[model samples]
Each structure stands twice: as structure tokens, then as C-alpha cells.
Target: MANVDQDSNLDGATEGSSNANAPLKRNSDDPGWNCGTLCDPLNKDAIKCKLCGFICKAGITRLKYHVSGLKGNGVAICKNASKEDKAVCVALLENPKEDKIAKRKREEEMRAEVEIEVEDNEFYAGSKKKRRSNLRPLDKFTNPINPEGPFLNMRQQNLLDALSKERTHSVHQFCARWMYESGVPFHSIDNDAFEKFVEAVGQYGRGYCPPSQYLLREPLLKEEVERTKGLLKKQEEESACNGCSVMIDGWTDRKRRSIMNFCVNSKEGTTFHSSIECSTDSHTGQFIFDYVDKCIEDVGAQNVIQVVTDNAANNLAAAKLLIEKRPNMFWTSCAAYTIDLMLEAIGKEGKFKEWIAKAKNLTIFIYAHHWTLALMRKFTKCKDIVRPGVTRFATTFLTLQSLMEKQEKLKTYVY
Candidate 1:
């Protein structure tokens, strides 16, 4: 029954195709025919073209293009009227000369009014001398702390020293524990400042000294965090060549809270490694815009080229605002994100799911036997994921390439 219905639909489509080739018949709706009161002077019998004997079509755009004067004839008539024909041999009668002049005046007035309306709203109101809270100059940052001694004392230092000696321990992990033991706030302190201090004193080719004793004194961390932020803001302003792109993404904290994280990135240079602009607050479109604005103000906007991100609406909106502000700024969508979106769309559409399920079942089938697992690994080369531009992913091509290579193996694990 379904096959019969499909065949019937196909037959109807074929009939429509045959009818499409039939020659067009002239009617009142034809383009070349003057349906209005104005008539072509040469037309009398069926209002036909006298030269080519072709009937005038309805809904002609303008008769002026069809009107032309011959050497002796008052006006030659259109014999070869067609949609594409350039030469018009027929003169369609026009309205009185005064009516044409009045229409021209009305069109001019309408155009003038539109221009005035555009000019009225183009300028926005703002204070020229205003200090935008977002754009704090470097001199505005005020140091709020006076230092004295090692942040931690001898006993806490001993524990940190012991933790540092352990192969698997990181100083950040050790510092967090030390902060907990010393009764000083570690999580509340500025992480970047603490991180720098720890690196400089404990691990920078200088043998492990209980440097937290000197560095982690009395919750100077908050001040350090502020100071570090201020320095970063200053460096971005001072060095216009910092060639970094900022990425912003949002997520919920463990407490089911919303947060935005801003990260700055760039390729490593001859003298310095690439830098990251980690924002102090949650990521938001406004935050991202302000960050880009500040970065542009610091380094000239022209120096920064492209911002790459996943196709999140907020990120897309931010890119638009950035482009409006800095017209030359280019935006590239993240390659991995683009490919994932394409594949996800395909999965939702029900094409890829069966294949994906098959891959999953293959994992179950192979893993049940140890020999099958070895054979599977030996027979299969890594899966090839599509690159960013392959569908929509253009930015971060390498990242997507790597992901695609492991796609078959990862698909089993990814769901």
C-alpha cells in the first residue's frame, strides 16, 4: 500500500514536469500588456505588436523602455515583445505630462524624509569626560596592603616541606592544605599571586624552602589578587602587541550557581609564552564585550584579528558587538564545537544514531572477549573526525582533528 502511494505521487510529479514545458499563453496578467487605462497607440486588433505580430503581455513594468521612434514613423510598434528583449518598438501611451512631474516631486520628498529620520537617531548621548567604570587607567589602581613577615609560621612550614617532597604532590594542593592547617584562608586569597609566590620561592631552581612561611603570611592574598589583576590590565594596555584572543564560557558551580569564565590566549612568542586573561568573575556577554573593548583600547584593535569560540548565542552576540566596535576584528567558530554541532544535529535527525549504536554494540561485543579486544585495536586505525571547516568548524582545526581520530573509540565512551 505504501509503495502504491509513493508510485502515485511520483506519477503526479512527472505530469507536472511535462506541463512545465508548454508555451506560455498571453492573458490580462501577462507582463508586456498594459492592463491600466494607458494603451499602446499602435495596438488596435487585440492590442498586438504591429511589427513582430506578438501579443502584448500584461503587467509591463514600464512602457518607456518599449517606446522608440523610427526615422519616418511616428513610433515603431513592438513586434518581438519578450521578457528579455531590450529594444522596444511599441510606444505605450503615458499619463499627462503634469502628473509625471508631481510623482517625481512626491518620490523626492519621501527620500528626503527618510534621510532626516536616519540622521536624527544616529547619535547616542554620553558624557565625553565621563570615567567609564570598566576603563580604569593604570594610575587608578591603589595598593592597599603593607607587608611585615612570612605569611605562615614554622610548624605550618614543616608540613608544607613534607608535602613538597612527595612526588605526586603539587604546591597548589600543598598550599591549600597548609592554608587549612595554619588557620589562614587559602581559598579566599588571590590564587595568581599565591601561585607566583610559590613558584618563585619553592620551585624555581631554588631548592624547596618552606617559602609559604614567608609568602603566605596573614591573608595578604586578597591584596595580591587585586594587584595581579591590576597589573594584567596595565600590561594589556601598555603592550599593544600582546596578540591574544579572549574566550568566554559559562557553567554552574557545584552549588548549582551560574558562572562565566574568561580566558585569554595567544601563540607563544620569541621572548614570552602566551598569556591567558582569566576574569575574576563569571562569564557573560557584557563581560566579554568589556574585556574585548579594554583589550582593544590597550592594544590597538587592529592588532587583534580573530576571536574563536563555540557557537553559543552569548559568544555570537559578543562577536557581533565586538565587530561593530572594531570593524576589522574577525571571528572564527571553534572547529571542535562546529563538528560536534553538526554530528549532534545528524544524531537528533536519526541518521547517525544507528551507526553510533552499532559502534557501542561493537564495544560490548569485543570487550566480552579479550582476544577480540586485541584484534579490534590492531585492525582499526583511529577514527577521523571532521575538521572545523569540514562542516562549520574552522577555528581550532588541530583540536578537532585530534578528536576525530579518537572518535570511534570515544564514541563508545561518549554516548
Candidate 2:
């Protein structure tokens, strides 16, 4: 940046130029042009010095730059120009008042040039004229190119029809199909195309647009769960119910480690132990009880009704703490498991053991063997009630009942 000091004169003179011997003068016709010796007296409406061409535009206010003695691109020679040309050109470039006027004049000139080109092109579209026109009129009446009919191209229309047919399926599947088969050589999608696709997908993009999970997926989902839990906690706080209930169960996997499942019933949604936390170490009675306490504190348990669990001693022990904390808190053993236990106890007394063993074997054989159902159909006239696919929980008594009634041929296996 260049600095213009008030004490400096335009004729490469500085501090010494402000002497009495120096006087500034201006011509009546010129506005900013001046000739002068510095510190000269000036008439009203007089800005230039006739002697030195120094500008006194701002009344001694100077523009200070970071660098001293640095000059920008040099100004043009205007002394030889006619007064009118000088005035018009200099005013066009420098006057703040002429900005809008100059801009309008340039725009008018550009519009005229575009009109002439379009006329010439119409007269000679295929006669040595280029296929494309660069300068087209902006207004609707004069514009030569416009989309008059169908909005989508052939490929886009086909994709739209396919997606409409499979409206029940996910939008991602639709997009994936079109993106793979569009066959248009890979090129940048225009703004209109991209926006159209976004509009087509609509709200389906919320969960369907795959998130880049990487390592943070679990952490992010956990945060979401906690946020949902907070809303449930708010509901619990508002309710006046005297007690809440919890249920606990555990199972050992092929890895032989006990995994627990806990459910806390509240006015809010049922809170199930997610698979991620099921394998955590909370199997013992004390541990499970402590875990429940922590969960209560997490949700601010003040109005719990009762806790319920299977006939596990650990569950009973944990129920003790809840009774102590809230005297009204009650515990109930699961009746379904209790009945199964009673049946198991009675089965040990007589020939019922043989029947139980045979039932277990027959159920397992039909479930674990794939060809047993077909074999059973061949031997007897009795129709098999088992469904014609893999049974997800075929070993359960409910599913095994269908298999046991079929009289399926048994296939033995040695493990």
C-alpha cells in the first residue's frame, strides 16, 4: 500500500515545498486537475493546482500506507486530452456519483451485442454458424433455447417408472439400481438432476442413508439410547405410581459365560438389556441386585411398584434390598418357571422318566435332522403339522409338539 501525506506535493516535492514562495493555482475548466506549489491558497470549488497538478480533494487529510514512498500503478497522462474527454473519462473512472450510470450504460451495450448475434445466428443456423451460441438474450421472449416439454430425459424417466412400481421397497434400493445401470458415462450431475433426486427420496433419506459408522457407531447409538432413556426418566418423575417393576434372566452361550438380561418396566417404553450389555458380568445375586440399584439411580427411581424375577435365589436376594428401601416394594416369582419346576420334580417319580426321555429324543431328532419330515410322510398316513422350513426354535415345547405328533423317522448322529 502507498501512503499519501498531507505535507507532500504531487510533483515529487515534500516538507520544503510549503514555503511562502510556493503558491497553488487551478484552471477554471478543470475539476481535479491542478498545478501548484504546496500550501497555496485556493478559491471555493477549486481543487487542482495549475502550477503542479497536485490534488487538494480532502482538505489536507492524507492516506497513510504501511510502506513509505511506495506508489501504486501510475496514473495516465490526461494533460493533452480535450476538456470534455478528460472530464467524461476521469469522471467515469473516479466519480462515486457516476457508478450506477456507467453500469447501466455497459449493460445496454452488452444487450445490443447479444441481440445482433442472435439475429445473425437465426439467419444462418446451419450455414457455417457454430452449433452453440454464447451470447443469448436473458428475457423469456427473446431467449432462443428453452425446455418446452417433458422434464426428465429417457433414462431418468425409466428409473422413475421402475421406482414407482416398487414403491413399497426402500428408496436406497431404487437409487442403487438406477445409479448402477443408468449407463450414461460418468459425468458431473447437473444441479437440476441432483436436486430432483433429493426431492424424490424425500424423508426416506433420514434412516436409509447409510451412516459411516466406523469405530464410533456403537458410541453414537449408546448416546441415542441414553437420550431416549432421559425422556423415559422424565415421564417416571412425573408419575405418582408408588413402585416400579424389574425382571432378570440369564443364559450361558457356547462360550460358557453367563449373560444376563434385565428389563425395567416403566410408564415409558420397556427398557430391555441390549445385546451389547447382555454379556457383561452381572450374573450373581449380589451383582444383579447392585446392577438394578444402579439402573434405578440412573433413572431416578422414586415410585417403583414391584420387581419380579424367575425362581432364582439371587433374584430373591436382590428383591430384599428393594423391600428395605421402599417398604411397599414387593417381589413375585415367575409362575411359568415355577410350574415347569413342579413338573420336573414329579417326572422323577415313575415310568414318566422313560416317556420324557423318548419325547425329548423324538423332538430333537425331527428338529436337528432336515430329511426327517419327508421320511415321516412316507411311512404313515398321518400328516405332519411342522411347518415346511427351518424351525427357528424347534426345540421349544411349543414347536416340538408339531414335530412329535408327526412320527418322523429318526436319524442318529455321534458328536
Per-model C-alpha lDDT, please?
A: 0.47, 0.48
Instruction: Write one digit per residue (lDDT tens) for candidate 1, span 1-415.
Output: 9999999899877865764543222324444443222234334323333335444343233332333322343334443545333332232323334678886676445433432122212222222332222212231122111112232211112223342344223334655676788898756564444434443442222112342544566455667777766757644553356566655445555776665454555553211212344445646677667765775555455556676678887777888888887787777787777777766666555665565555446456766877766654553442323233433323233434444555544544433
For residue 378, give model 2's deviation from the true position in Å.
6.8
Candidate topping TM-score? 2
Candidate 1 similarity to native, TM-score: 0.31
lDDT, candidate 2, 178-213, per-residue tens: 667976444534334454445433312111223455
- The per-residue C-alpha lDDT of model 1 at residue 147 equals 19
Segments in model 2 whose C-alpha atoms lie over 4 Å from true places: 1-243, 267-269, 273-284, 346-354, 363-374, 377-396, 403-415
Q: After superposition, which runs of candidate 1 have C-alpha atoms over 4 Å from their true positions? A: 1-239, 269-303, 346-351, 358-415
Worst 10 residues of 1 by lDDT: 139-148
